[model samples]
Target: MKYQKVLIVLLTICFTGWVSLSCHTNESGGGELNDGLIGYWKLDGDGIDYSGNNLHAELIRSRKRPDSGSTNDTEHNDAWHQVSASSNLKMDDDFSISVWIDALSPDRDVSGDIISQYDVGRRKGFHLSLTTNPSPTGVGNSRRLSFGMDNNIASEWMDCGRPGQALLAFGLAEYNGDLYASTCEPEAGGAGHVYRYDSENNTWKDCGAPDRSNTVFALTEYKGALYAATGKYRVAGSSLPESENTQIGGRIFRYEGAENWVECGQLPGVEAIMGLVVYQGELYASSLYSPGLFKYEADNTWTRCSTPDGKRIQSFGVYDGHLFATSYDLGHVYRFDGTEWVDCDQVGQNNTQTYGFSVYQGELYVSSWPSGKVYAYEDIKQWRDVGRLGEELEVMGLIVYNGQLLGGTLPMAEAYRYQGDTTWQRMDQLDTTENVKYRRAWTMTEHAGRVYCSTLPSGHIYAYKAGETVAWRKSFPEGWHHVVVSKSANKLSLYVGGELVDQKSIPTSDSYHLSSGSPFNIGFGQHDVFQGRIKELRMYNRVLTKHQIDVLGSPD
Candidate 1:
């Protein structure tokens, strides 16, 4: 229930619910093909491209998360990075290339190119991939399906397997010509099945679900057909309370072609419908425990429109033409002005929370929560904040790669790259974990020049293209060393003067996550305190082992 595949990886929206991030478009891209989207890259370790058309891609051997990259060190694959450069690239057919493949060793079978645009002798394009279908004990990968696609030159490869409890492919769509995905199994009673790959009989079907919600998360396309969105039903590890998150409420289905599909209703008892948008022409949907934004109109019907129920609308965007969003409730950011949804005022304060939504050149950018910053917006009200990824980071998805903006962060599942509109640049680290149990870096893609991310628990796959060498950091030990820190309720520790250095497992909140109930006083907050003074101090509510602070001698 902890993952970080693709490049900025990071997933575990509180475990149990399997692989996360339901679409994401810019609103940055949750896949309905971001128009001329081009080589987006979100891999941050830089492969260039930024979509301006430079088309970068190249990193073959990647590494980052070295020194304190410590996630208890299960570390095996060594390190990887390779944002493709060219198999000709330039793609079209409506585009649609999603990534975030962190699958270290479900026993192995495939996975090396998170977003490949093949030439295969001209059969050409497509490769959003992952593997694990062979078994006898050699490869069943928890159960199966780790996200698949290869039609064109790879001969034929249309995967959509995730069985053994499930967790793969959070979002990707090309509609009708085939290529729709949005799963996340986690051993439940149903909600996880949106496969469909047939890019010309390459095969793979399923294409169903969403009555009691097996977990469809999201799958775009809008005005013509393909439109999915549902919630609740995970069961694998567990986490349901939002009054059951959905008794069949927040749904939305449409497809109707091969395996059929239908439904298109829901949103009354509402508990989770995450995000979806088609803008001006039609289709809307978004919510989380009754938040707001529902439109659709005919067929199964829908109406609400604006927002106000409880607030939770996580992501959405569309610049210049209008409709912008971001809200984990208080982190606000609104903008829909043709009639309602105003408030462009919040960014991170009440517990942080606003989430990733992208729009580069035309403005709009989000991804919030205390130290993991990333604001931008512009008119209706203003909001800049810009740059961040440390004070306990938590950015989850965004894309505009190659020409700028690229983000994804959560408990260290890094990936940044904005260099301008407000500054940002790291790019890789799906693996080196400080481990806050790795939660939500969900999805942010850009196929062709490579740039994909789909992380959750360690399900890795990072690529950012073009010659590299960065990864070094983890040095420490310079001089004036006399530090000590500790925490409990699952653990966290560190020391320098008395030795010990580092420790892990704080699972979900602690280590003085800084809200300040007070007392650890030195110079007192602000400059980070104790530049030189502090003759003595001690505070112990509990958790002080190491022989109880080493017999307390140093304080003398």
Candidate 2:
């Protein structure tokens, strides 16, 4: 369908169902589609509006579409159809624009513009386009839906945790009487596999693949069925282009009785969905594609809803009786206050990447990247810094268990129990061994009276029995580490060479005024004895910056 001067279908009028929109450019106010849709371009060969209105699309084909002369013949990166500034294209207080097109090349670096008159810097006009998407597994040619208005500043077409960085487990949920999670181990080509926790056996059993996809990112239960959102279409055992590790699309699947699963639908404009939630008796899903909120109506039936103030809607959770979601790029939170989505403000810090959302103690909390800190939601105006989980960058998965919230961290690939928003306790040594050593704890859930978790790299699930949490804190192996521990009436600081690594409050009155003994029997006197070899231990009368600590702790 190249350039035939064809009669293009411009969706103008509105309808009862958003999926079933009314768009006949024949005349304004003639059909339900009413936001003054002025111009229409057929791209058959011209930018003439078919609405009987004289407004025509301008010549701004940054990349022109070559005339194939027949639909069978295809054209690649021909050009873009566009219209200059027009009041008709401008958006109002509330509006929606829809389009129908066959995106040419998903491999194109610059996203293919579907429709828009947006001025990004001015942040005024609206834009809809087919943006390139690389699956979590590997980069492959793929295009997903993306849309945003100039007013919506954070409107980027794609988000995978962080820009250009691989994502951890994208989805997690509870089903039946057991907990289930999907693994996104792109490095091992173990994508799109599901695992079910068997508490009785204290292990995970592979649930197998839902379809031929890289990974499953979102899982939910609705109306007596287990639904899994899966995508990232890279061929197994093949290396994507070193330059572009683009992930493909994903689909929605339903557990068809016992172990069987069937396809129910796919995320609109996007191949995969980040998070899903049951709100007001309706199932809503968030996507980096169309980059907005969508409500599921039926199989293959979803309606687009509100747009967020950020680029990508990474995940969603219901908090304080309201549906709250996090936008990844801007690290901001938005809430559904029954009527529409309202900006609940953003997390303040260098970590602009917000990953998961969960509510604990009736308060809302979100996990972030790079900084690896969690923040508590008080209102749209303020967020309390809940502290860091460790030195991990991506605090990928977060869930509530045992009357407390648990978060999963990256690089270390471990889980931590949140304590009073001030301290965090290690969950356990679930990931023990080499090979799969550096994975992240992707998801944590409770099943059969136990906490079960899943991790990346290995893409395996493990169960945690009711017992004392382990404090297997290890020290820098033979190297110089600047470990700094600050002291209070009840606590003392622990520093390696110079860095403020960790701090714990141990009772007993004794300050380390000397560089001699095992520092009060490794402190806590009765807990245990030091098992590893120790070298230079220094007591500093002052705190040191990371750089100074590094220099002091350096082995060289």
Candidate 3:
């Protein structure tokens, strides 16, 4: 067997087997196989010659394709497989799944025998089309990994018309009542993509590719909004294929608590995206072409920094600094270089397919989308394959926060967060403002240890005192620009474009006056007094110096 040695080692993985039999897995499916191989046998034991078609099996992993970002390989891709009822793809309460697969060309014909539950003549259910190669759109080549619900199900399969070649297929899985899928490709020109099947309507909506010219590079759903990244340009119009695109660079889009996708802003200077991950604090996107990664500071503006040379960025997470990420196509882990991107000697490469990347317990983790294994590169060379998941688990956005590893699906509106233990939690329906009904937080900032989340589309700013919602908000001038606080003094001032508008003195001495609770928002702190986007805000404990106040109150 081509992978005989590796296959034996994989079959021995206890964690992989546990995932297959465990019922706790989240809806975004993918897991390893069990020892008995009764249920949905997760793709494990790499060398096993399942080519004989004796047992139904599935493989799940992340996707990690090349792009303009990192020269190194982060192995951030995921791959998985779905089998027939005989494959026993049922789950109980708690489980975790992961996998990796190098996709073949989309032109290759894959009969149900290679991926589905049926034999050559068995018309059991769905057909598996790995990659859509020689595609209509010349820009991005795509992969369609779908399954029909048995002959009775009428959903048509969007066949990619390719198979057996080393394309990238990460993984997919079903846990509890949720379902998850992923894919990986170059961040440039949106080569890789993903989609979601609305079981309620029996429809497959275009989750990633909004247009034909741009492919989906990264995707995630947070707080009810769906976030996706494309190769530096804004994508418009459906049905248009990426193959016709001429723009370079990348951009991120948001589907705010609604079905329609809205444009957020352009990704500063990023031309291509290798990986995207949310760690510690904010959203992070890496450029496959550029060594630098962009961090969402508040809204459109990003904190841009470059990675070490000889290595490109694949994925990112927050380890020690505010961020951490991996390099792909080249195998390495790149950490925040304080001022720029530097290689984290602490996190080196250990796996062959380093496609997907994340951070957990102050440790940097990388997943091999092709191999269907996850490796942790902490302080040494102890690389081990934790387990497997559904085939083609293309991990798009990997986040670790509040003691959990949150993974995102590319080209799809699915999100999953690991619940510390072995169980995975599905957060399919995020809080994208629908629950709020009226309030839509556009940006947030911290001042004097206090957090403030600004609500846009309504021009309201809400303040929190000691994490508790407060009743202070200040309205901005007619044209608010830099609504910032002075450095030396506690003065909140506003500057419209290149002119100072107003300067309000925050009573630092009189607790009673401060207790009265002024406006919590910068623009419109009082009533209909201010408008426009606030450029900046800062706060200090004491009164500011004349120079500091002037600086804060100075026009651009």
| Candidate 1 lDDT | 0.45
Every model's TM-score: 0.27, 0.49, 0.34
Best by lDDT: 2
Winner by TM-score: 2
C-alpha root-mean-square deviation, candidate 1: 26.0
lDDT of 1 by residue, 1-556 (tens): 2333432343334342342333222212323333344444444444455555555544332222122122211111223223434332433222222222233322111222233323222222232222111110001111111111122211111122332233444554444333455565534353556665442443446665555554666666654456777776333322222222234546787777755778868777665576776555566777755567777888677887656444656566544345666776667777674457667777745435676565443344677765688776655456667778654467767764333346777766676666653457675565453434544455654332334455554433344531101111121212232333444455445444555544444334212222111111112111110111121122223344443344332433
Worst 10 residues of 3 by lDDT: 132-141
Candidate 2 positional error at 209, Å:
3.0
lDDT-better candidate, 1 vs 3? 1
Q: Can you tell me which runs of candidate 1 are displaced by over 4 Å?
A: 1-190, 193-272, 275-312, 315-332, 335-342, 345-380, 385-406, 409-414, 417-421, 426-556
